[model samples]
Target: MTIDLPEYPFPQPTALEPPAEWAELRAKCPVAEVRLASGDQALVLTRYQDVRQVLSDPRFSRLLNADDAARVTANESGGVFGSEQAERTPVGEGHQRWRRLVGRYFTAKRMAAMQPRIQAMAEQLLDEMVAGGAPADLVSAYGFPLPVWVICDLLGVPDSDRVKFAYWSDHMLSLTRYRQDEINAAQLEFGEYIWAHIDAKRAEPGDDLISDLIVVADAEDGQLSQMELIGTAQGLLVAGHETTANMIGKMTAMLLADRDRWEQLLAEPALVRSAVEEALRFDANPGFGMPRYLTEEIEVSGTKLPPGTTVISSMAAANRDEEAFDNAGDMDLRRTPNPHLAFGAGPHSCIGQALARTELQTALNVLLNRLPGLRLDGSPEELPRREGLIIGGLERLMVRW
Candidate 1:
């Protein structure tokens, strides 16, 4: 008997939550062909096992055919954060060098040390939110600022330039208003800005990631070029801030929507860490997933995916696979052996996950403590969501104490 494949309404990266259809897809076609908005053929992986394997397995590569790579890396019009050569470069030694140079600074140890500072930043942001009074938009006042501040602090970016950086970062990730030209321009401009900082740090070395990268670039032969270093910095700046910010907003909103869970968390503050993990599992931005492309024809879960086909692994679907988790839809803070792929898997697993977890735990704790009666100011259904973006999050999260 032939099984019916589930259909997803929005584009792969478009935000439309409660991906109920994905359950059917996971069961029916662990791997299936899907059409992209650009009218290209793409493969979709829904099952936890299949998605995890693809991510960890080196057989399926990050680079696609030249045409597909161009399309994939093309900047959105009106974007302030530009595209980089690193993104355009297919698999090569340069890629390895770029990864190694940045990886050193983002080591687990460094991220652990940043936890205390992240917590402090979260607390300071929440303090400001409390001072702002009731019916405040958490997204604007706290959720967004915490990650931005933490990233800026780590990168040694001046606080005065944060507003501009924030704007550039948003446009960089935004798919709606930005075209390739705009994104490329923004990326070049940002690269120049970072290079200037790197140059300054060379003369008067600072104790920061950028300074560290500068040292590596200067000392190592063929490790990283000046532009490459700038590109790395820009990439870190964007990733470090944007993804965490959205996750913070989405996780908080998810908790608020489920009052019992919210109350449970508030009552047992110790559960904050697990609660964050569960939230990460339960309410992942539905449309966003890691993108891969087949370097050669490969069979995935009985499906023959041709070379150059774009494959999207739905992390949201993988996390909620019923086969993997009992009552996968439910938020259980006490969940043990929960192996959610929220940080993804393999060599490309999120580098800042440790710091991100700390930020979430700290933010949630401070918010619940400072505002015991914290409740949604408006209906969740009424809240507007940003569209045409890979990351899923609310435009604003208005709340009251």
Candidate 2:
């Protein structure tokens, strides 16, 4: 059952709408070929089970720098996907060890403890947004800054340098947005800044993720090499800030896009937790799905994939599979026992998920409590999405209260 390979990330009619091809592909060709921005071809998995299987399987690796692996973007550097830092990132046992060491800080309990601080930050940002007046772009005013502030605090990064951090992060994760030279320059500058920051932390440690990791590294006597340490910081800074920031805006937009959803939340505040999870599950534009380079032959959805093949798991598509969820297309605020692959799956699942969840829940709570009248200032369908980035998100969430 072979079909023409459509461009990967099939086009969407609107910012909030899912691509029509997601359903078609999932039903007809669960395992199908697609072309990447780099003009390389790869197979995309659209079924729920197959997507999760490939992600959790150890045979499918994140080592996308293999000579034969398909480049993810048009840029020669491969953006973050094929970057030197990504190549150096530990895999297998070494990767698990790195996760164990850093996972301690992101546990549910720790995120729960950090909730108050996150709430305070959200409130302050909301206050400033309110003071500035309505018809505001929530993406810039509220969504962007909140997560950056949280990540800065977590990494002990100076808040004053957030502008620079944002710039570096953009180039690092960009798919078609930045040129190769610009990406290289940004990486160099970021590396130098992180190294200097590490030196400063070594001289004077603080109660932050990086400082704590440094102490452990020092105690373990180079258990984590300097490169690993720097990569850890850079990875956390980018992942922590970008995904959650986009999500905050998207979640709010999803709720307000339907006034009924907002009214339901206002009526039943207990649904906030489940609502956040649902928003994650319901997000249609979550950017490029996870890419894994196969080290061994594998068959997915009856399609045989050979070694040295690059396969993309379209979690967004899987989330909407009717075979996976009841009435999968509808956004049910009360959808309980919801499990979605928004953070990915298996060993490589997002380490900062707890923190992200906390921030989102807190943001929603604060928005509901303070701006009970919050409503979309424009049509959700007309909203613009951020272009030329690996991650997908709204460009601006126009709202007024």
Top of the candidates by TM-score: 2
Clashing pairs in 1: 75-179, 75-180, 76-178, 76-179, 77-178, 77-179, 82-183, 82-186, 82-187
Global CA lDDT computed for model 2? 0.81
User: What global local distance difference test value does model 1 have?
Assistant: 0.68
Model 2: per-residue Cα lDDT at residue 395: 88
lDDT string, candidate 1, 61-112, tens digits: 6544554432232221000011221234424566656666666666668777
Judge candidate 2 at residue 277 and give its lDDT. Answer: 89
Q: Which regions of candidate 1 are displaced past 4 Å?
A: 1-16, 64-101, 284-286
Candidate with top lDDT is 2
Alpha-carbon deviation at 86 in model 1, angstroms: 8.4
lDDT of 2 by residue, 102-124 (tens): 88888999999999999999999
Q: Quote the lDDT for 101 in model 2.
A: 83
